[model samples]
Target: MAFSLGPRAASAGYRLAVFDRIGSTNAEALARARAGETGPIWLVAAEQTAGHGRRQRSWISPRGNLACSVLEVIDTSPAVAATLSFAAGLALEAALRTVSLEARMRSPGSENVTFHLKWPNDVLAGGGKLAGVLLEAETVAPDRLAVVVGTGANVAAAPEGMPYPAASLRDIGIDIGAEDLFGALTDAWAEFRIVWDKGRGFGEIRRLWLERAAGVGQHVSIRSDSSTISGLFDTIDKDGCLIVVTSDGRRVAVSAGDVYFGAAASVGAT
Candidate 1:
């Protein structure tokens, strides 16, 4: 199956490759980049056989999910390049909002059920996960980098037996097709990309992310490989470290860990 893009992607000179099935869009984009195809190109798969998510978790792709990877050049350090995942999250949220507001325009009160942005790169809806992102970076030249933003969104169906609660657009009564979401994503990405300005404008991105942050003032816990920290999810710092205030009143800045909000015991990741 082929996917289509609107004027924004076209105007940005972005290319697209859509497939009916693939092992993983991120893997494909990485292979192309290795062969010197450092592009602002997007690869989408209608279905995936061996999809994966952050920390190498399997991302099961049914026929109706939106699975895609975006490859772009970056003139920054690997640390900074990784922040594009935040931009991807914002773009995905915007795309979802377009469909959501349209669905509940007449009865706007239902916007409360709309999706939210979890720190890093998770989209939450109905207090469950709606989408995820995985980022990988490769240094192509001495000062040039290629980063792939891989995203898997629950469009038609959310996976069952997931470690965390999951919800899909259709599950929430937001009727949308994978192709349509991709188009909306492209437009949203273009706008967020401009706002990001290659990491220079991340302060704005950080603020916007905070504005949509889920459970910021709520009780939360983050699990490390060997331990867990429980605290109030105060905010995310300037460099994206999660700022949490422990019960002892000590502020801790957690850089990497799986965060859980409330007593859900469910792990929603970026």
Candidate 2:
């Protein structure tokens, strides 16, 4: 079924385009914006042929996953615009919490049913990877910016043999479709977006994100192009970079890297 956003989106004049298959919704959003289709728009796909995540890693975009991108013209600088990933992560957490509430009502006393946001832009459900957020930006003009926020979430299905374990709402017993999840996600995005306000609300966004952050104080390894750092996952700095406390008590700030908790390799996190 096609994704149908509610009146909130309709009233705001937001545009949406659905694709049966695509290389990447993020790529499509960028392409469309460059073609004079600038908008507070969304592009969604049923499947992807070449989806990718942070650091050029492959993102498996199988059917039943939320492969979507949101694009908009913004008035913020590129540095501030990057914080949208945190807003996107918070939005996904809101959506999951809303649905998890309903699931709990039906199956009372559900244990370990919680959601978390990994540093940068990944969401976790019960400590398992559930969703990812990718941010891309381009200078539309001297004073204006166009940004693409790409997201992928498992709704009805999850992939296997991933670096970190994968999970879907269905695997956790919340049987829903990608379209439905997108509907909730779109609405939730609107809610969290007020806290974004063109990067003016980074402080609040960072605070709220830290509340849902996963591995904040856990033993972890951060992998980069040629090296790895083992330490305790500290808070994300004000500039949105990861701060890791090394085993010997040195604090190192990482602007970008893949984080792993213990033996599991973390994916969709940067």
Please tell me which predicted candidate would have the highest TM-score against the true structure.
Answer: 1
TM-score, model 2 to reference: 0.91
Native-vs-model 1 lDDT?
Answer: 0.85
**TM-score of each prediction:** 0.93, 0.91
- Model 1, span 106-218: residue lDDT tens: 55655446678887679999657999988998888898988999999999999999878899988877776888888889889989999988899999999898888888899
Off by over 4 Å in 2: 105-112, 263-270
lDDT of 2: 0.83
Which residue pairs clash in candidate 2? none
**Model 1 lDDT-worst window of ten:** 261-270
Model 2 C-alpha RMSD vs. true structure (Å) is 2.8
Tens digit of lDDT per residue, candidate 2, span 27-101? 988988788777888788999878889988888788888899899888888888888889999988888887777
Per-model CA lDDT versus the true structure: 0.85, 0.83
Q: Model 1 reaches what TM-score against the true structure?
A: 0.93
Supply candidate 2's per-residue lDDT for 254.
Answer: 86
